[model samples]
Target: MIYFFKLIRWKNLLLIILAQLLIKYALLEPLKVDYGLDTALTPLGFILLVIATISIAAAGYIINDIEDVEADTINKPDSVIIGKQISEKSATNLFIILNIIGVVSGFLISRAVDKSAFFVLFIITSGLLYLYSTYLKRITLIGNIVIAGLVSLSILLVGIFDLIPVISDSNKSSQLFFLSLIKDYAIFAFMINLLRELVKDIEDTDGDYKMNIQSMPILLGRSRATKLVFILSLIPLMIIVFYLSNNLYKQPMAIGYVLILIVAPMIYSTIKLFNATHKKDYKHISTVLKLIMLTGVLSLLLFQFILLK
Candidate 1:
């Protein structure tokens, strides 16, 4: 049971759920807006959306593991499960089941919102994850972009599910406000995941090289790839700094938090990245990126105090 959960990366799934919950309660629910949702249906609606996101994400993990078995044998041998602890056949079964559950949940939610047409988002999301694992991931940098796009979609999924259906003459302003907020979150997700995915490519360059996976690291060489990742990692930091300079410079605590916890560490990571040549070095750098991602997401909380003032 533990292995199964680990295999599907339940931790990350939980993070996705938490992100959605924070968006709802911390950000949206408090706003003086209709939100296009009945207060009565809010909890159950959120739960269904959370379940659907987890199912699709879990299915993605299963197929990625199945497709990357050989690559994992090189990069993460001890953790590969498709043909060792669980058979490939069983993994495929789990994939189908997860997709079914995800799509069904979306279907039900669509009906509840009177937006049955939006169910296609679920179907398209599942199919794309499958395609990513099976083919797109083997192509090269394009795979990273695809997965990053999907991560952004997860943030937007909540808006599509809960806020869109209620848009009308009266609630249009409220709906637009939520949509803008969701868009900000989605862009944050994209930037963080794009950075992480590039780091992962560098981390797995060895396995990817042997498997002819055509990853950025394999095509660009580790030295260049690390440089590229370091360059890319600075993007969000610079953006945030500028954004805060204009937006949060008036707020001492929020600006301090970004400078110390977010910006400073990222600068250190870039320096560490340049000296990192060994696989273990790349591994640590990858972990640093993961922490940065968490810090980025948690920055949403700063909005609370910012909004209060």
Candidate 2:
């Protein structure tokens, strides 16, 4: 059971759940936003959505682990679970079960919301995850971008499911406004995840090279890949700074939160990446980036107060 949880990356799944809840309850509900006003999901419905999302994500993790067994044995032998603690057959079964549950729940939710077409999002996401594990992940840069897009999609899914169906002519502008804000956050998630994925690629270069995987670090030398990741890391920093200056300049509390929790840590991560040489160093930077992502998600809470003011 413990190995199963580790294999599924329960921490990441929990983060997904938290980010979705914050967007739904803390950010949208507090604004009395028109986007979800008409077709607002009840608490039960929202729970179902979260369950479906996490299940799909879990299945993705399982399949990724199954496919990466050789890579994992080299990268982190002690942590490998697919062949050590669980058989490949059992892991594959879990993957199929989770995908079934996710798709079925998504279908039911689409019907409940009267937007049956929305079910395709889940189907597409599932297929992409499979392809990513089996093939896309070996293509230089493409795999990182694909995975990051999926991460961003998870954030944007809240807006799509909650806002799109409720939108009418009367609330179209307001709906788009709120959705645009969600899109910004989703973009943020994408950029941050992209950098982190590259960092992980660098960290696991030895294993990836041994397996003939063509990750960024393998295609471009380690030094070049590290330079690229460091440069890319600056993007989110500039974006947040611009956002703070333009919108949150007068909101001391909000600015302080962004600076301390978001901006400062990002700066630190960027600096650390500049000198990162060992696997442990890249691993630490990855952990820092994950924390930054969590802080970015939690920053949605400040909007409750900001909006009320």
Candidate 3:
């Protein structure tokens, strides 16, 4: 059971659940009350949506682990689970089961909202995750970008389901306004996750090389890859500064929160990435990026402060 939880990356699945809950409750709920913004998901339906997203994500993790067993044995042999703790066959079965649950639940939620077309997103995401594990993981940069876009998509899914379905000609402008806010957060997720993915590539370069998997770190050398990632890391800082100047300048509390929690750590991470050499250093930077992603998501809670007042 413990190994199973680790295989599915329960902690990451929890983060996904938390982010979705925050989107519906902290962000959209406040706006709905203060601004009369319409939302589509009922509590029960929202639960289904979370289930669908995490199930697919869990499946993705499992399949990725299965495919990377050789790499894992080299990269972090002690942490490898697919062959020792969990059989490859069992892991494959679990992946299939999770994908079914995810896609079917997605179909149900899409139908519930009278948008059956939205069901395709789940199928496509599941397919992409599978392809990424098997084929795309071998490519340079493409795999990282694909995974990062999927991370952003998870956040944007909330806006597509909750905000878009309810948009009317009367409230189209206001609906789009809130959706744009969600989109901004999605973009933030993309940037942070992209950096993290690149950092992971650098960290796993030895293992990836053994498997003939090419990455930025492998192709350009770790020093060059780290330099590129360090440059990319600054993009989020610029976006946050622009966002603060244009949107949150008046809200001192909000600006302070972004600076202290999100922006400061990002700066620290970039500096660390610049100096990073050992695998442990890259791992630490990856962890910091994950925390920044969490803080960025949690920033949605501040919307209650900004919108209600």
Candidate 4:
């Protein structure tokens, strides 16, 4: 059981579940009192939606590990599980099984919501995750963007299911409000994950290079890769600053919290990325980026504060 969870990067899986729950409960539920959760889908419907999300994510991890088996032997030999504890055949089977479940559940739920077209979303996500492992993982730049966009989709999925069903001609205000917030978080996730993906490329440069994967690090060199990540970090940093400057300024405490907890750490990440050379250095950079991502999600708690007033 422990090996299974660890294999799927279970902590990260749980974090996804928690993040979705927080959005559904902490954000959407409160808004419901003012508007509506806006879904004709029952509790069972939302449960299936969460299932679809987790199933696709789990399948992604399985395939990612399958592709990483060779690279992991070189980069982190101790972590490789494909042919050791779990056979390649077994992992592939699980990948197929989970994807089927995710897609089927999505198909049913899409039909429930009068959007039969949504089944394509599940299929596309599954295919993209597979392609990301098989082909894109070897390509430069494009691979990182694909994975980051999928990460954003995890957050956006909730909004899509919850809001899309009820978007009539009448309540444009509610529909637009939810869509805007979802887009904001999607962009935020994209920036943070894109940075993390590049940092991982730098960290895993040794294995990736041996695999002849044309990652930014292997193509551009370590210092240049770090510089690229540093440069890209500015997009999100500026976004948060503008976010703070415009939205949170009225609440000094909120502004201070955003600046200190979120903004400062990103600035610090950029500075640290410059001097990082060893794998361990890039490992720290990866961890710092993960922290920033978590803080960005947790910042949603502040919305409660604003709503209370």
lDDT of candidate 3 over 154-242, digit per residue (tens): 99999999988999988888889989988998898899999999999999999999999999999999999999999989988898889
- Candidate 2 ranges beyond 4 A from true positions: 33-39
What digit string (tens of lDDT, one per residue) describes model 4 on residues 29-121? 777666644644576888888889889989999999998888889999988888988888988998888998999999988998888887798
Clashes of each: 0, 0, 0, 0
Displacement of residue 261 (Cα, Å) in model 1 is 2.5
lDDT of 1 at 231: 84
Stretches of candidate 4 above 4 Å error? Answer: 35-37
RMSD per prediction, one decimal?
2.1, 1.4, 0.8, 1.5
- Candidate with the larger TM-score of 1 and 3: 3
Q: Is candidate 2 or candidate 3 better by lDDT?
A: 3
lDDT scores of the candidates, listed in order: 0.81, 0.91, 0.93, 0.83
Please, what are the lDDT tens digits per residue for candidate 1 over residues 103-198? 999888778777889889899889899898888887977889999998889888877776777677777776777678788778878887888888
Alpha-carbon deviation at 75 in model 3, angstroms = 0.5
By TM-score, the better pick of 2 and 3 is 3
- Point out the higher-scoring one by lDDT: 1 or 2: 2
| TM-score of candidate 1 versus the correct structure, residues matched by position | 0.93
Q: Arrange candidates, best TM-score first.
A: 3, 2, 4, 1
| Pairs in steric clash, model 3 | none
Best by TM-score: 3
lDDT of 4: 0.83
lDDT of 2 by residue, 24-50 (tens): 999888786533455457787788799
